[model samples]
Structures are given as C-alpha cells and as structure tokens.
Target: MTNIKSQSWCWIEKGEPEKLILKDQTVRQLEEQEVLIENSYIGLNPVDWKLISSGGANWKKNHIPGVDGAGIVIKTGNKMKHIQLGTRVCYHADLNKNGSFSTHTITNGKNIIYIPEKVSDSTAAAFPCPCLTAWQSFKKVPDVVNKKVLVSGAGGSVGYFLTQLLIDAGAQVYVTSSKKHHQKFLKMGVLNAVDYNLTDWKNVLLQSINHNSFDIIFDTVSGIHATGLMNMISYYGHMVAIQDRVKENTLPAFTTCISLHEIALGAFHTYASDAQIADLMIQGEKLLNDIGNSKFNLRDLNISDFEQLPRHLAELKNNNSEIKYVIKV
Candidate 1:
C-alpha cells in the first residue's frame, strides 16, 4: 500500500501564524493532472498575512500558510507535459485553495512553471506570486512611453518589482514607502520616494513637480487607510490596486476623473491562452534572470523549516521585509 502521508502547514480561523491551529499534517494523494512536488523553498506573499489578520474568510477552512514555492517534480500524472518528472521548478499555487507551506504538496500541473538554471531557488521562489502579479498588472497598463507612474506601497515584494519594471520601462517612477526605504528605493531606481508616515504626505507630494501628476497609480495596500495618492492622480488617470479597499473609508473628495480597479490576476490562470502564458513565462524568465544576476537589490537567500512550517509562518508574518522564504524539504 502507498504510504499516503506527507507534512504541511495550515492556518486557523483568524489566528496568528504562531498559534498555528494545524502543523505537520499528512497530504492527500495526487489526482489526475496533478503532481506531488517536494518543496525546496517558500516565497511569502501579503495575502498569507492578509487573510490571517483580515481578508478572505470565505475560504478560511483550508488556509494553508503559503502560496509560492520551488521544488522538484517527484510524481507527475500521465497527462502532464513539458514539465517532466524530477524537474526543478517554481510555482504559484492558487491561494483560493491550500498553499505551498509543506514538505510536499499535490498541485495541478498547469500552475507549475519550470525555473531557469541560472535562477537560484530563492529568486525562483520569490518570482511566483509578486513577480507574476507585477508582470500581469503591467501588461494590462496602456501606453508606457514617458508616462508618469506612481506606485504607492512600493516597498513590499510586488511593489518592489513593479517599481523596478516601471522604471525599466522608461516610466518616471514616484513611490511612497517608509522614509528609511527612500534612499534604498532611489538606489533601486525610483525617480522619487515619499514617506507615507509623514503627517503631511500630501503637501509634501504637492511640493514636488511630479506630485498630483500621475498617469497611472498602482497602489497595492488600500484595505484600511487612505493612501493619500488619490489627491495626486491627474484627471482621467487610472488607479489599479492588488488590494483595493472600499469599506466606508474613502479618499478625500477630488473632482479629478479616475478609474479604479482591483486586480487579482488569478483570473489569468483561467482566461489567458497558452501563447499568452508563454509570453508571461518568457517575461518572468528574463526578469528573474536579471534579478538573479544582481541587476537589482534581491539576494540569494534561504530559510528552512519543513515540519515546523507553522512556526515559520508565524515568524514570516511577523515582519515580512524580504520576498523569498524557502522551506528545505
């Protein structure tokens, strides 16, 4: 008989990662079009902590502690292709379901993408969620030549890459993050950085020539407080959010015409064609290569805990400054 056993991490109902309701649990068998992957690294995302402290309670029961992981393909169903058995790969599993916080996980082969040899495990692991989100979000933006792009919350994983990509694309980049990150962000290529903690960030931004003057604003954290960037948007500007907040707490009144969007990118998994996905993968491959080459600020890093995933999640959720968190299986 098959052992039918593996270890994984899961979250509790609105609980902290340390309180970890479930730890080191056995995994189920792989279904068709599914593969059993031995996880090598873990990439932490905002949603992991977001759901824990705040959102997505509907799918709360199966809340595994992670979403991004890199691993070796151990078992593949007969129908799988391209991604061969025993291949080293990285993946962004669907967060709606359980995630990659375990020694082994059963996942659909479609969501899995092969990592380039040049990409380290930590870089590859980091690329899945934030990288993909940034790529998908940028592809949706309109003209890119000389347009002013304002990225609020541009310090986290997705925000970091989004800022880098926008700067690389020739868009004048304006950012909002902690003051301490201002110098680092400028070094990372942001044209300008605003301190969100400042009491008068608006007036501070208004003083700058590019302030209140953006064509596109990508704000990732908009759940609780007003980002104050709403005042900076030019008329007819587009505001895109990975976490658009709209619960009573609204932005200050501004007659400027604005369009808001809450971009999940998960729908891309279902709607994007093979060629489209291939294009995304191609983009992902190149960016990851650049990042791995020290073209940017990312470093080759790893932190491991297989059976102790719950504890790890707690630590990660505590202070998520970096992007990748690999679980040495």
Candidate 2:
C-alpha cells in the first residue's frame, strides 16, 4: 500500500560477491497478488554465489541477489488475503526476480509461508532452500522405513536436513563427512559415519557396512563423486543427486535398474504448475511446524550483519564448513 526505499546489495557485474554494490532503491507498487516484506534476516546458500559468478541470465546491473529470507509482511496488494500486514513469514525468491538480499522485497503471496511462532527469524530464513530441497529429495524415495540409506556430504545444509528426515522416518542412515562431524552424526543415530577425508574412505564405508549396498543414496556432492557412488546402490534402489547427476551413458550397465533423481529446487518457481507450487508451500509449512515442535535438531547459525554478507559469501565459496550463515538485515 505504501512505497518504500530499500537498502540493498546489488549485483553490479559477474564474478564474486565483491562485484556487488550497496544502494538505496525505491520499491514500486506491488502487483495484485504480491506482498511486500521487510526482511529481518537473509540466509546464505552456495546458489547465491554461483548465480553471482554466472551473472544469471535474468540478472541486470544492480539486481538484488538472494533467495532465502524471513521477515514481516509490511504491505499486501489488493488480491492477497491469506497473507496480511504484520504477519511473520519466510520465502524462497524466484531465481529470475529481484531477491531477498535487500531490506525489502516483493514476491507473490503464494510463494511464502507463515513462520511458526517458535521458529526464529534466522531459522525460518535458513529453512527454505536446503530444507525444502531435502524434503523433495526425501519424498522421491517411496518409503524409507527400515531401509539402508547413505547421505554423502552429510555435513552440508541439505545433507543435514535429508539425513535427519531419513532417520526420523526410521531409515538406517549412513553418512560421509569430515571427521569433525563423525561423532555428531553418530550421536544423531547415524549407523555409521565415514570421514571422507581419509584416502580410502569409500572402502572404509563399504567395509563398515559389511559390503552391503544401500537402498537409497542421497548425494549432495556430484560429478565424479556421484558417479563413483553408483556401484554402491542395491538392485532397483534410488539415487537422489542435489547437484549434477551422473551422466546416463557413464552409468555402469549393471546399475541400469537403479533410479536416478535430480533436485533443482529453484526450478520449481519457473516450471511448476499451480498445484505443485501449492504443494511446495504446504511442504515448507510442514517443515516449519516440525521445527517448532522439536522434531529437528536445529544447528546454531553463524550470524553476521548485513554489510558482512559479501565477505561471508566469499568465504562460503572457498570453504566447505558446516556452519549456516544468516545475515541480520
């Protein structure tokens, strides 16, 4: 209902976070189905930096670049009823649009969910990308109860959520991450935790599991690593890849019966039907509710002020640390 000026970090050119510049920009009138949010916190993900490096096809000079945020709905356009002014919410912005890195952002009402009362702004902001991707990836496998599952890169955000979801659903979970995370994973009920830093970690993993193949493999590390994990799948098992999937031609002939799934959560904004989009919000709300109800062991977020976003992003690009970064806007 009211136009506001937002202080935002804008993409000036492609390369790294350093290319972004801070500026005050005017938010225009919202479309009938859109809502205006005053962002309280912004969550960082690898995709943010990756898109910055590529200068996303839809990006222009001074385009705001972020996907995850939580805040209050300051204004709502005429057609919005479910989302009201002053409602606390969180969202994953459409990749092609101006995003959540600003003090304010505009998104369709359907693209966001109400934050549960018990969830903190940082947790809500951090949940959408990795948690939703994990939810979708977990759903790809039919039923996990009593099944043997492996989560590669289990120390990462998506891997962490996926691993917890699998364990909560009664799957016997195995993980491969840094040695520092081994004890944590074990304490969380992981049947085995292999330190991928070891030269023969994969062999160690196999030996620890008694050479038995997994019924499902959730791979957060792709490329040759994903391909290498193929032979470890049981007959008719499923493999969900969060990054690039193994090329079909390169798949071992004996592994032909296994199912391959690829998860690109951002693509949902561009390609999903109305029903699918609705389901996305529903699933997100479920995750939020779960978080509020103590069904998840939330990780402590590494907090930073808004101005430190670029520096944190640069560090994220170069490091594989498990710390989740949230920018207080």
Candidate 3:
C-alpha cells in the first residue's frame, strides 16, 4: 500500500468551529480490518459541533472532527480485500478515532456501507448519522401499523426520517414543527401537523387527536420539553428519545407501564459487540438501498466547499436551521 498525504480540518483546541485548523498529514497504514478512502463529501451534524465544544477525554491535539462521509475506497487491508478498490461507500466514523473531515480517512471495514448506483455522494455522506439514528429509534417499538404515533420536532433530519417511516408503515402520524413545514408534513401523509411556536401547542395537538393519547411518541427534542410530553402517551405505550431521555424522577408512576428508549448511534462503535456491529452494518445497507429506491425523500441540503465548513458549522450551532449541510472535498 502507498502512503497518501491528506488535507484535513483539525481540532486544534477545545472551542467552537473557529478553533479548527486546516493541515496536511500523511495517511497511515491500515490495520487488517481497515480500508482507506478518499473522501468526496463530508456531512455535518450537530454532534460534530457539540463534540468540539466539549472536547472528549479521548481527543488529542490536532484531531480530526467529523463523523459522516462518502468516498471511493483507494486501498483495503489484507482482511478487507473483498471490499474492492474504487467502490463508492459511506460511513459514520467512530467518535474516538480521527474522522472524515479529511481528504482521506481510514475506517473499519464492517462500519462502511456500499453506495447504490442511484444514490448521490452528497446524500450518502449525509445519510449515516441522522438516518441511522432514525432507524434505530424506529426499531425500538415494532408494531406501528394503524397505531397512533407522534413525532416531536418533525422538521429535523432524524424526525423527518422517523415520521416518513412511521407513516409508510401504516401509522397515523402526527407532528409538531414550524408552521413552514406543516404543509410538507401533511403531504407526506401526516394526520396533523401542529405549529410548535404556539403557547399551548401540546393542547392544540391534543384537540387534534380528540384528547386521545398516542400509542407511540418519538421525541427528537428532549430534556424537560420531552418530559412534559409524557402525559400524551397512552398507558403501556412506548417513547423513543433521540436527543436526551426523560429522567427517572420525571417518569409517571409504574402503573402507567410506559416503555422508554434512547438512541445513541455513535455509542455502537465503542460498546457494541462484533455481532451487533455487523447487524448495524446490515441495517445501514438496507436504509441506503431504501433511499436509492425512493422509499424515503431527501431533505433540502445546503452544499458548501470544504473551506466553508467552519463557518457552516458555526451557523448550524447558532441558528439550529432545518437545512442539512454537506461539504464537498
């Protein structure tokens, strides 16, 4: 294998996006189960900026700070020979490892997903984190057919995917998001789309549902805001939190018999067993193929050049805009 030099955005210190520095470094040799990819697009997420703000214990000086990317494989280690060179692929990088903000990145073979012919590099790059989190959250409660479901924060990426998946699975989906997204959610088969800006939006939604409790509530906006949503769930119903879970003290009495679940996709890298990791890959491939087949719609994307990453990330952190960001490398 040849050593290739890569231009990467490095986290020089603990701070916001402004602290990131552009640097040139040599891509090191891959391990037996790793493959080297030349990145074409890097996807940005809130977690990227959040991690930068609160530097982790595992972080080192000049560490790369991105998680999602789509690229072409240039080389594979001996054990990963089955992944052909030049194959188009996308991956969510392990949080503890140097990531995809570079022109090249090395990733474990099992963590990569082959991009379908119909999917674009930008979509593939942006798919893994939010989409995977949505998929995992969807799996938390299985039987949604004809069930009453609510997706809080439905305008966000994860909420978008979860809303679509639940609707397509035959659930009567309801959502709370900005007024601008209401019509779009309605077009996607949502039963009701409540504008969350209202003072008593939850009451507005309750009236829409005729005061009936939801069978399942997928909360993308968590913390106390999510805890306040507990009363809307039916006894014995399920709640899946994508951001932060409700605290134990905030939960209703055990007689309510509610089930709670939390999604942390990045934790899979450090905590999952080999079999679980393989299953995650399988699920990721299925989601990618579903996108290629037009089973799910892509959101509006804000594409920018590599050099604009820091500026875009800062905007993402401060504005909390609905548009997804993809950096072309």
Candidate 4:
C-alpha cells in the first residue's frame, strides 16, 4: 500500500468553468462502508460544468468537482465486505462529497461496481453516469417489448444507451438526430431517424411511423420539443426526461394522457434504501457485463490527458459537439 497522505486534485476557485485550478490536497481516512479508488480516468458530464457555472459560496468553499470515475481500489473501510484492495471498479460519486476530479476518491462500497475485463478503463469511466441514468429512465416504462418508443437527443451518450436498450427489447425505437446521423441510427436497427433541426421534422417523423404514435418517449435534452411531440405519443404513454426543470409547454401531454417523469440520477443515491442501493449495484454490474457484447456505437470518444482537462472541459462547454469527454488521469 502507498503511504499516500495527500492527492493532486482540481479545485474550483471560482464559479466560471474555466477558472478551475489544479492543486494538491490532503486525503481523508475512509468511513465504514466506504472504499478509496485511485482514479485512472474521469468522465465528464454536463453537471460538472453546471456546478462550476454556479460559482456560488457553497462551491467556492469546497471546489472539487466530478461525478464519473474508474480506477483501482487501494483501501477499504473495515466494515466493507465484498470489495477488496486492488479491485478495478467504477462509480458515480455522491453529490455531497468531494468528487472524482481527485487522484483518489472515496465512494460507498455499495455504489462501486467491478469493471468488466473486456471493457477498457476509459470505457468504464464513461459508463456510470450515462448508463445508470439510462437504466433508471427505462425502468419508468417497465413493459417496452414490441412497443413504439422515441429517444430525443439520440446523438448523446445517455440517449445512445437508452435507445440501444429499447431496441434490444424488441421495441420499435425511433430517434431524433441530425440528418448525417439518420443512416447511423437506421443501421443500429432503429425504426426511423428524424432530423430535429428541420422545420417540418415532426411531419417527417409522423410519416415514418405512418401517423402511429409512440408508447414511450425518452427525452435526454429535456422536454424542449415535448409540446410539439406530444401529439405523436399514444394515449397513456410515458415520458422520461433528464432536463425537465427547463420551462416548456407540456400541457398537451396531459391532454393526451402522457405521464412525464423528471429523472435526476443523484436522487437514486441520495434517497435510496439499503435494498435499493444493492439492486442498483447489481444492475450496474450487469450493464457493464453486457456492454462487451452489445451493439452500442461507443467508438471514437473525445479523450484528454489529465493536463488538458481544463481546456477540454472549456471546449466541451463552449462547443456544440456531441462527443462525451473522458479524462485519463
């Protein structure tokens, strides 16, 4: 074991995303039921930038920011049972704690899952946030077999995983992406791909399904187009969104009997019971195990070495690129 008393971590000095600074900080001893992971790669998510953008007194006091990370376990709390030192694992960091931007992070043993041997460290880093969110979102509609489904923001990481899950379950999955990605979605076996940027894209989507309606709608970009897409959903259908806090006209959904779910991934960790946490851990491990044989289009990631993390995050925030950034720490 390393006699590591401190770790190098990125600290948020200001609320501005570009104002993050790299610094060394003392490591804390783990609590019972917690484990320390030496992060090899950290996955970036919109929440990271959103936190820094607030630049409030709370964040200024505790500057560490990150959520997704994959690494080797170097230490375990005495009460921890299954996990051992030297296990390679990945997890979503608790929102209340110091995050995964550090070289070593402490996470609850129940939250950490083993990374599959077939999956690389970078890929493992990318799985926790998006895959876990997708898994929880799909649980909203428990019976998807042979049903019609739609995934907004299909080009995104969460949408990609959600769509794949729906498709593999025999659902007639449709997606909204750029025209360039239409064929890509088709090749992935989605029923149709609509270019959301077009003025009359709704009509195109309606025609693709021959005016049939979707039974489930998973909107990763919130419900920005929900009002317009409401009429396309079948009566009593379910809708799940990651960004439902945004102001949007969703009255039409009620008229058509659509149930809207606002999914916040943090809530799963924050409010879960002991049994629920154990179930989540099991689900996470199963998802990782299956990814090796899945047809998910997970190639060509946007990656940066530890030194370039700030610049990469700034670029990720400033640009409209669809790539998910992963930091090799």
Ranking by lDDT: 3, 2, 4, 1
RMSD of each: 3.4, 1.3, 1.2, 2.4
> 157-219 in candidate 3: lDDT tens per residue?
899988998988899999999998989999989999999999999899999889999999999
Off by over 4 Å in 4: 1-9, 55-62, 245-255, 295-299
* TM-scores, all models, native as reference: 0.84, 0.97, 0.97, 0.92
How do the residues 15-108 of candidate 1 rate in per-residue lDDT, one tens digit apiece? 6766555455666666778887888877766667666666353566556657788888988766675567789878777656677777777777
- Higher-lDDT candidate among 3 and 4? 3
lDDT of 3: 0.90
| Winning candidate number (lDDT) | 3
TM-score of 1: 0.84
Model 2 scores a TM of: 0.97
Give me the runs in candidate 1 sitting further than 4 Å from their true place: 1-4, 21-27, 53-63, 210-212, 223-228, 245-255, 269-279, 296-304, 320-324
Candidate number that wins on TM-score, 1 or 2: 2
Give Cα-based local distance difference scores for all models.
0.70, 0.89, 0.90, 0.78
